[model samples]
Target: MKNDNVILGIDLGTSAVKCVAMSTSGGIVATTEAAFPLTRDLPGQAEQNPADWLTALELAVTRLGRDVTMNAVAIGLTGQLPTLVCLEGAKPLPSAITWMDSRADAWASSFLDDSKRQMMYDRTGMPIDGRYLAPMFRYHRETFDNGVGTILSAKDFLHFALTGELATDPSTAAGYGLYDLDGANWSQELCAVWGISSSLLPTVRPSASASGLREAVAARLGLPSGLPVTVGCADSVASAYAMAGLDSGTVCITSGSSTIIMDSLPKPLRDSQRRYLLTPHIADGVFGREMDLLSTGTSYRWLNDLLGWENGRIDIAAARSQAGANGLLFSPYLAGGEQGALWNPNLRGVLHGLTVQHSSDDIARAYLEGVQFEIRRCVDILAEDSKIERVVLAGHAASHSATMQMLADILGRPVAAYHHRSPAAIGAALLAAPSAAHSKQMPTDKAVAVPSQLRADYEKIYRRYCAMFPAIAEAAD
Candidate 1:
């Protein structure tokens, strides 16, 4: 029989809300998910109604309650980071601006002076990009006429919705471009430069600290009032925590709508070239993490869309039919470019080395290879300072596909696939687990590993793909 003291972890994602209930022994009791749409008003504008997240959270929690015993001890929340959510008191001033939105490119570009950019990067471990918080905040202050009282990231906003408390964890704040990793607080220098006040930001809190929940929210979800809510980290950090391998040499690679490669570091390290970003870990002030963000599974989605294969299901078997993709090479930069190598948004997608012999299968294989090549680039960058011994892969795309074996082989490292369905929720649950004083000690769970057979062939293709990037970059130029 399960214990009455349960912990619930909620992941309020850009596309969906997922909730997981866990027993005190670290066993998953009940899980539920509810999805919402991303509203694209214009070519570059990606927004979501904040009300949608609240509605999804209510439904997901309500569903969880119907299937399980109502004994949630604590709740932890995690989701997409750096998305700007403008709020006036409790209400939203504008729809949540998603992380993918790049309307602030012009605003961000003007601050590209080498010295100023380097200074900001040195303090924040983040580059001056439109996807970051500073640029988004600037956009809101300068463009929006509506009164704005506070700014919260997607997960932070959801936390506020649930707890009626405005706060953010260090992991989420690190990506905002306002956080000073060296100082461990919001940067007054950057705030002054951007002409924004620091008071508008939420209070910074630890990842697992008890963020109080509101009675009204608990009543709506059929949960107990005053349930202890842990201020959770970003999805990547939370996913890393769920993997439970936070040693110095281990890396966590999440291949989903995007590929995020992050590894733990005892202290901050900067490169002369300013390639990678270092962010605070969930256990802030003690550990830091390095990240390389790129489009991974998104490339596959793009190819599938191009082939009109939108049957809403991925046909992996068909993709295996064309070995080596019949010499096709694709550059997977559909949603613009990411870290290390920034490309112009106007740069068109390419299908190089196409021939009359090529088929849809070839395109699919090439698409997969292109994303792997990007991952290899990130791995190479991180290897500059950190000795990455192994990589733990998480996310629906990485867990479901045999193609991930190709990625493991290409990187020449063991790739362990952690729990597939929803790691963010599991990570959140781990974060919300009652303190040792409140429950018995439970053994930590390890991530599930992918088979070794898939790694061999994938390594061969990865080597050839890596050799092809210079020429591809030249072509794009």
Candidate 2:
């Protein structure tokens, strides 16, 4: 039977645009996905067309095959953030500079110094990488004829596309590395340094704030013209919300192209590891500590493509391999610009202990293990809550049994995967729910128990992985 009360949740991810329709009485009634391309046309340049996101979103919603006009009470959205979505009014000027791109490094270096970087970090709750809004503003400022009018993050762009409103929440705003973390507003001095006028920044609002959809957009999408749209948050915060605990007791890991380990923090905090960022959670007075690995699934994909295997898919070959992958070790930093502990933009991925007997399968297993080791490393730095036992894992990359079990054995804690396919999208739906404080739908139940057998071997290999980073990074330096 169809539930009368349903909400549409959409997330714009690096690999695809995902939608989950949830009923108030039932759990997730329907889910849909439409894959989109994230291209690297040049080295250190990751680009995506905003129009493609819109088309993919429409297709996914159509695939849901639900009567949004009758059922969907509200629409909630979330997306990858700090994405430099350069816009003139509602239309994108050209390619959106995604979070993965590092082309703004040259401008960042010229504009920021040791003292200045720390100053910006204090204001933004993160150290500036080339990915932030300020660097993008400075780097590509001269490329446009009219000059870039307004820069918005992925979720912010989606909101504007739906409601014709230019606004963002603190979660996405902080990702730009120019948000006043203390003031909860745009940083005027920081914007001045990057030649970004504060006037161009969107109006900041709390996540879950509401607006009515534009009539034209609603008619085109086959929805009610004045349907309520809840302004949602960034992907990391959404993943945290899906974990079902917005307090200090819960920890969530969103493992995708990048690995993001987040914990609900009570107040504003910073880690000694400069790359570990602090951002406001969607809920008021809640904060999140996010430690990110730039390339987790990206490393896996690269290895798969290098061997000419099926792309965008991981197989059981990794599980068939031994715990240590025949002594092979990999550092999963192939994509450059790591947000993890080292904070090194030039850090390169390394593979050690390859032998003639080792198969491509062993290498694949090593790649998976390598990313897990980095997760353990970053989690140790960002997680202040010491009494935690397990991590709630979302995102497809680390949700696999082999990957989760390896992570469990590595971190010596059970890994709980969301029963639902798209927890991030579900989190967005929660934003639209009447009670954002609770969920009527579901709970995270697919917990991957840690096997004691793999611990001894994994612990030894993990040490070697950690030990090798210094020598390899030094050699590159």
Candidate 3:
């Protein structure tokens, strides 16, 4: 039953590596995932040996069965971006930094003056922060002062590994905080400002551009050499492309290790307030309006681990626990910044109205509510900027019925959860396909309607959630 018409999509995410085989008919043939193993090791630092990511990707693709590769016409790559990687061609000079690290803060502050920082934000659609490439690169340039390597994002490294081509997509490049959004290329002025050469970065390429896979790499993975490979986008963008109908009027929420809310506009939207991140979408002239929440699924997973709920058992607690988690209110901030908020990396999680009477179930449910409430807040911000009548939810958090229902009720809008477990990979596959005309990635029939029962209840608690952010800030302080 092996067919050569299938394309492979590789998604290297924060918690895992997922490789999916999708057929020409747009149906998924197989998928496999490998969990994270590399270390955070230090506070404000997260590093992974790049080799581990490749090994994990190989393992997942390998598990898709030998036939998938034998049949895989092309491989599309996507992963976390703005993470630091110093590369000596195919070999990494140092461990790849995860997006979670803030070791670039001092470098960012020293490199960007207030005026230049504002220019960078306006042009790049990203704030001057440690999660960006400029600061991360500066940290390496100042610390090790290494002159032996080039800098690339995680997916760029993967594409280089596969195709021997050092390149990045406009979508990926826009997140680096180095590229010129208006010019759609690397900014020589900014490079001069940072006292760095443009040679340090990858060449810009279209997202769907393809190259022949390298012989050695192909042989290592048991795939044929000269296989076609697509230069894919970042995970959030890919998820939006794969799952959401972004041709105006619709918004997408990719709820995974983080929560990413995005919309598509005819042109890029710049926020002088520095509240949103803008990036080019897969479609020409269309922009992806994006915001991030660092700990959405992570928050839910954290509570699940605390409650000792295994797999599908989590919904039971979340579903049974009434709205407002029985009077317990929670704000999920298990990590650094809760992007789309005040942009405070020091923000902490808060659980108010918690009493001995509340069980772990109540706490878990409360955490779920907290994350969706944050999404509601983000969508509201987006509405102020543009019109969004409907929403499409994708990723791990979106799969749960309770979470979807909660989101729909809280937002008071129709919320469609992606049917596919790996929308980003599916998205990459579409980009890898030989022809642009393919089956519908997201059929409207798959959408779910909002439940009316919980809207009023959630509206009441949502106000309470909004009121708690200040108190949460005080508690964190």
How far off is model 2, as Cα RMSD?
2.1
Return the TM-score for candidate 3, rounded to 2 decimals.
0.94
| Candidate 1 lDDT tens digits, 24-57 | 7777788888988787778778888888888888
Best by TM-score: 2
TM-score of each model, in listed order: 0.90, 0.94, 0.94
**Candidate 2 — what's its lDDT?**
0.79
Q: Per-candidate RMSD vs. true structure?
A: 3.1, 2.1, 2.2
lDDT of candidate 2 over 1-477, digit per residue (tens)? 374678888999887899988876537778999988888878788889899899998888888875643578889889987788888866886688888888887667667778888888788888787888778767877876675678888889999999988999999999877789889998888888777788788899888898999998887777778888877999888878877557685678877778788888678877544657889998777888887888776776777788888853454677888888888998877877466777777788777888899987888888878878888886766545445655877766444677678778888777777757677888888888777424553577655656578888778888888888867776654
Ranking by TM-score: 2, 3, 1
lDDT per residue for candidate 3 within 1-477, as digits (tens), equals 377478888998887888888887777788899876757777777788788888887788788888777887888888887677787655786577778776665556566667876888877888767787766776667554455468888899888888888999998887677788889899988777666678878999998888899998888888889998888998878888887635776888887777888888888888767778888887678888888888677666766777777765666677888888999988787776556655665687778899999987788788778888888888888888788978888776565778788888989998887767777887788778777534357553365868678899888899988887856666654
Which 10 consecutive positions of candidate 1 have the poorest summed lDDT? 437-446
By TM-score, is 1 or 2 better? 2
- Relative to the true structure, how large is the alpha-carbon lDDT of every model? 0.72, 0.79, 0.79
